[model samples]
Target: MQAQARGRKARRWIIFGTIAFGAVFLVVGLVLAGQSVSLLNDAERARGTVVGLEWRKDHSSSSRRNRSDDRPAAYPVVEFTPAEGTPTRFRSSTGANPPSYEVGERVEVLYHADSPEDAQINGFASLWLLPLVFGGLGLLTSGIATVVALVTRRRSRPRRSLRTTGP
Candidate 1:
């Protein structure tokens, strides 16, 4: 009985901890989504070209690599002429392993009127990826927590024994 009580207490603490962790992720995801929406509302759009690719070592991959499979990630360097400023060139914050863009390819750019240097490539991956990932994680965690709580509650309910009296 003491062990059972201790286990129940531990389970409750785990559920609370899971909920808290999930709430933090959800809050971060919502904040990021809000910032992205605000940027889109206040940003100006312009046409840009992929001037070049800035290649960087793939630190996320394994240290040991085969000769033929070792390729760095390619981040696009875009050049655009803002409405009221001279031509500007900025490297995108997002990069891909297989090179998402080619040199001389035209792409849409989003920037503030005053700060063209901090421009971003206007695309789903560039703006929405982080928020979606965090939000999905939060939802998934919360859902698992809920399922566990429900199962625990069902199991903890007292079961009555059937009794029969013969006359």
Candidate 2:
């Protein structure tokens, strides 16, 4: 009986640990996915100008961060009249970098034609990271929740059979 109790306690700890860890990952993934969604919404409302291209030093593609960091990636920020527009800049991970476009280069951005402000550079809307991140997260959360539920149900079943013979 004591061993049984100990076993149950151990199982409970395992479940608790699994739930906590899974929840943390789920939250992070959801946050990333949510941000991507928000970016899309903002892009739809964009009419900003090519304020300038910022070479962000921190953007990296290195397998492991080392003495030599990944070269800065180029991103553009365009300013719109009246208020700043949202859709601005471009990103790519191809081995070759996009040509350096200058501040005054005349370029047209594609956006929600319904609302000019809601827009994006035509070629850039297909970023894969957002979808992959969300899909993997949804799968992980579902699996963990399913396992925890099954363990809980199995543990609650009574060991004795519900039958009686009366003399």
Best-matching candidate per TM-score: 1
Q: How do the residues 1-167 of candidate 1 rate in per-residue lDDT, one tens digit apiece?
A: 99999999999999988977887888888888998898899999999999999998755546546557677779999999999969999999888888889999999999999899999998888899999989889888887897898899898989889999899
Q: Which whole-number lDDT from 0 to 100 does residue 108 have in model 2?
A: 43
Q: What total of clashing residue pairs does each candidate reach?
A: 0, 11
Relative to the true structure, candidate 2 reaches a TM of 0.45
**Candidate 2 lDDT tens digits, 1-167:** 99988987898777777666666666666776675566556544333445567666564545645546456556655444322333334432212135445566544454444455444443333333545565566558657766876878776887788788899
How many clashes in candidate 1? 0
State the C-alpha lDDT per candidate.
Answer: 0.90, 0.55
Give the runs in model 1 whose Cα sits over 4 Å from its true position.
58-71, 160-167
Question: Stretches of candidate 2 above 4 Å error?
Answer: 44-131, 134-138, 160-167
